[model samples]
Target: MRRVSVDIGGTFTDCFLAFDGSYVEAKALTTHNNLASGFMDALGNACEQVGKDVETVLSSVDAVRYATTLGTNALIEGTGPKVAILTTAGYESTVPLMRARGYGDGLSEAEQANLPAANRPTPLVPVTRIVGIRERVDYKGEAVLGIDETDVREQIRRLVDEGAQAFVVSLINSVVNPAHEKEVERIILDEFPTHLLGSIPIILGHRVAGRKGEYARTMSAVIDALLHDQMYHGMSSLEMALRKAGYKQPMLLVHNTSGMAQMNSTTSLQTIHSGPVAGLEATNYLSKAFDQPNLIATDMGGTSFDIGLVTADGVKFYDFNPILHRWLVSTPMTYLHTLGAGGGSIARFDRMWNAVEVGPGSAGSDPGPACYGRGGTRPTTTDANLVLGYLDEENYAGGTIKLSRRRAERAIQEHICKPSGMDLIDAAKAIKRKVDHNMAQAIFKEVAVKGYNPKNFVLLSYGGGGPLHACGYSDEIGISRILIPPFSCVFSALGAGNMNQLHIHETSLYMMLYDANLRQVLSDFTEFNRTVVELEAKGREDLRRQGVPDDAIRARVEVDMRYGNQLAQTGIVVPFRRMETAADVITLLDLFSANYATRFGEGSQAPEAGVRINVIRVVSYVEHEQLRLRPSEVRVGTKPVARAQRECHFPKVDGAVSTAVYDASAVAEGMTIDGPALVESPRTTFLVDPGWRLTMGAMGSAWLEKITK
Candidate 1:
């Protein structure tokens, strides 16, 4: 397969090219002003490695896939049109109140646990711009009160007069019955006709998400509308750039759902955190290729560290109601945990801890790390790494940007050393240790909270900065094996190339599989089967439009079940496609019970209280030819040669050690690299800490194992 996938990050743009089964990865500094320049530059680097030109590569590839942080960055920068929301009457505070926990929606656990210090995120729509529509719809799709079309038009006019650039119609129970929302859309369009007044995009809540929670669903539609213009224009520019370079196929976009779809089929909400999701996808493929399961995929980039999980049994994990930039939205995105611990994460002296603090703030590409000599004055993880002698000042990022050791020393001394009364090396050591501890704690909590043991999983580290600190954090978290997957630097981009054309359709409903009050089982399967069919049709239509045959499209069923009106919904995967008989219902109940037990505990299944299915989801996908990671015979006898020596400092390891630095490329497949050692690649560095060993594998995959006493 001839394909290309690019992941545009905060600090860099990564490109992964698959040219007739020969895979190559490349990276370029992100050009934020015009993203296409960065994309083309990264792609050009990849092309040059294989002796190909830009146009020739673009014109020949079957597809170009992108997993980008475009929407995330835009949302963070608040770069979007003014949004006006039209919610149901008496529901004006729904989005504002944020389900009473708006204060800590996207915050860390420590922040969430503090109630007095809680504060809501800045409103996406001003209270004055949010007008209520006089309409009512019950949960079961029954309209109790009629919608006022004249009233909607008047309210819309009021909001438009208030400088509303876009509109969001999110009525109560809109997912159950979208009649009121549809009417509002029609009235808005009539009032602002596209032919005369120009096209004005009006977002309807029911179309964005098929969930019942009004607040989450409303935010989903609002976010979708907010990101619509930015995502469209940005992605459109990229597509046009690709087209100019001779690419004719539709540019596929990776979704936060861990699925890839054509731009025509993507929603702005689905594009959030897509880069991290793609990295998880690549982790999944590697897990299968390398026959390793229960892996933790960790990506330590310049600005952030993202962690994702892949269970041994291949059960996909998803965040049904994930938060994006501090706003909760109803979207079933692939589950990923991101921390502000990266090379560019700012390090500071913490008065409280009397030590060091890593970030929730980053020094992005503009004035990167202080060591980059970009005029940054703050101490950062990169500066600490540089001061510790782990990084080659002259060869960082393949020498694209030269590092200033003096700048690093100055930043650390001023910000950390002087304030804490510690020496420069000591302060740098504290920074590294603190950041590693923070990451370990984050990973531990993430795994533990999900009812899994972190010790049971292998650490699959990628990204440019991951291998540098893999040993530090993994040791702290009680992990031993670290598999830096093939093309580790551009791993997320590689994951994008493996995605299939996919779509997900779902509906929120109150389904009682077993009514404890009546002591009767839900034996009749008419409604259950009908809902599944409806969802399947929607997904089928989506795939069919994308040129997939009905026979080629496959579907998976998922039901969000809970016990006794519990707010927590456990998504249970239905093994069978659809319920046909009484036996199928039993199968679903057993599946839900087992899933509940696995997540909570053996004694936590309270099916006797009641079994309710709140949501039904159907995933439709057409598989593509994946880039197979062909295995290499495990040859462990090859010896590696050292290229140079460096005096590097390791935290908790007392004195500076003279570490043998090896040319990463010189290490043949299956060669063993012993510690204390450093393997230097143009794009990244692999640190073999004391008591750990590294082995090179096929397609640039490496294994780092602990040497136990």
Candidate 2:
């Protein structure tokens, strides 16, 4: 298979190319102005490695898939179009009020606890522009109030006059019945026909999310509309670039659903955090490739630290209504956690702590860190590393950009040293410690909160900054094993290459699985089986449109069920797709109970009260042949070749230690390197801190572990 996958990040555009059996990785500075340029540049770099030009490479590849941070970037920059929302009458404030807890949606617990400082996200659509029409849909899809066409036309006119570039119609309970929403769209099109010069785009809520949450579904439509123009033009321009380069296959866009779909099947909201999701996909593949059952994937990049999990149990984790930036959206996204901690994470004096604090803020690539001498004056993690002699100033980013030691020292001294009354090195050490601990805490929470013990999982670290800090964070969280996977810099791209073409269709329903009041088991499988079949057919139609043979496509059924009226629902991947008998119903109940028991402890199952299935989901996917990362069976004591040596200062150590540095290029799969060393590559630096050892594996894979001897 010849495939190329690229992840457009805030700082770098990473490319992973698989030509036949050989793999190559490349990265270039992200060009926010024209993403295509950076994408081509990174691809060109990969082509050079494979001894082919861009035309030759593109013409030969079977598929070119891309994962991007563009949607999230646009949201953060607030550069999307002026979006207005249209909702059911009296539900005008649904988007504005944000469910009472909207202010704390995407924030950390501490930020959420500070009620005095609570504030909602900047409105996606101004309340004034959010004019409502008289329409209502009951939870059961019954239209209680008819859509007033005249009112809809008037509201659209008012919104257009009020400068609404795009429209979102999110009537309450529209997912159950979208007739009112569909009518509103038809009315909107009538008023602003395609022939009109001022014709605007419209987004319906039901088509965006099938779940039954008013505020979240509304935001999903709003965000999708807001990001439409940008994503459309950007994606179109990128595809054009690919076509121009002799690539004939349609470019596959990775979705946060942990799947890849052609541009025609993709959505703007699904593109958000896709890069990180692709990284998780790669972790999943690695988990299988290396036979590591439980693994914690950590991607520490220039602006964010993402954490995800992969276990051998085949139990998938999903965030049904996850907060994107500050707005909760009802998209069934693969469970992934991201923190604003990275190499460019700024460090400053925390008056409350009387010590340095690392970020939830970043410098990004533009004017990146003080060490880059790119007009950034703040002390950042990169600067701290530079000051501590971990980075090679002359060869950072393959010497694409020069680093200034003076700037790093000045930034840390002026900002961190004076404020914290610590020396420059000490302050840098403190910054490193704080950032590592912060990441460790996040990992612990993400794993333990889901009832998984941290010690049971091995740490799989990737990205430019991941290996640099993996040892520190792993040690803090009691994880003794860390694997820096192949092409760590472009690991997300690797994931994109391995992802299956998948589509997910789900619906919200309130069905009683066990009727406690009536004391009857759900014997009539008509409704339940019918819904599951419908969802499967929808997914099947999608894959069929994508040119997959019906036989090649597979479907996995899942039911979101809860005990009694509990808010938290347990997602059960139904072992049996259809329940035609009482025994089948019992089997599903047992499965849900066992899964729930494992998650919330054995005694937490209270199904004696009743059981209900809230949502039915069907995942139709076409699995692709994956890249295999075979483990080496070499002896562990193989001596490493010394490429160079450097004096590096580590935290809590009195003085600088003369550490042996190895050239990563010369390290073979069977080679092993000892502690207090640096594994230098052109694109990244692997810091093997004191009391650790690294065992090199195939495909640039390496393991950093605590030195027991």
The sequence of per-residue lDDT tens digits that candidate 1 reaches over residues 1-709 is: 8999999988889999999868888999888888999999999999999899999999999999998888898888878899999998899999888888777888777788896797777888889989888999987899999998788888988998999888999999988888888998899888888686546688999989998888899999999999999898999999999999999999999998888899888999899899988999988888888888889999999889998899886678888988888888888999988989888899998888787899979997878899888889998999999999999988988888899999999999999988899998999999999989988988999889988899999999999899999999999988998988888888999999999888888998777888889987788778888999999999998887777898899999888999987877788889887677878877888888888888888998887789988899999999999988865678776778898999999996888999999988899898997788999898999999999999998888888999963
Q: Candidate 2: deviation at residue 228, Å?
A: 0.9
Count clashes in each candidate, considering only residues at least 3 apart in sequence or on different chains.
Answer: 0, 0
RMSD of 1: 1.4
In angstroms, the error of model 2 at 412 is 1.2
- After TM-score superposition, what is the CA distance of residue 408 in candidate 2 from its true location, in Å? 1.3
Report RMSD (Å) for each prediction in the order shown.
1.4, 1.6
Model 2 lDDT tens row, 1-709: 7999999887889999999788989989888889999999999999999898999989989899999888998888778888988888888888888898788888778888896697777887888888878888787789888988888888888888899889898888888778888888898888889798868888999888998888998899999998999999999999999999999998899999999899888889889999999999988888877889999999999889999998767777899988888889998999998998998899899888797899988988887898887799998999988888888888888787799999999999999888778988889899999999999999999999888899999999999999999988998889998989988988988899889999898889788888888877798888888888888898898888888899999999888999999887989988888888988888888998898898888899997779999999999999988876676667456777787788888885778888888888888887778789988887788999888989888778898989863
The stretch of ten residues in a row with the least summed lDDT in candidate 2 is: 628-637
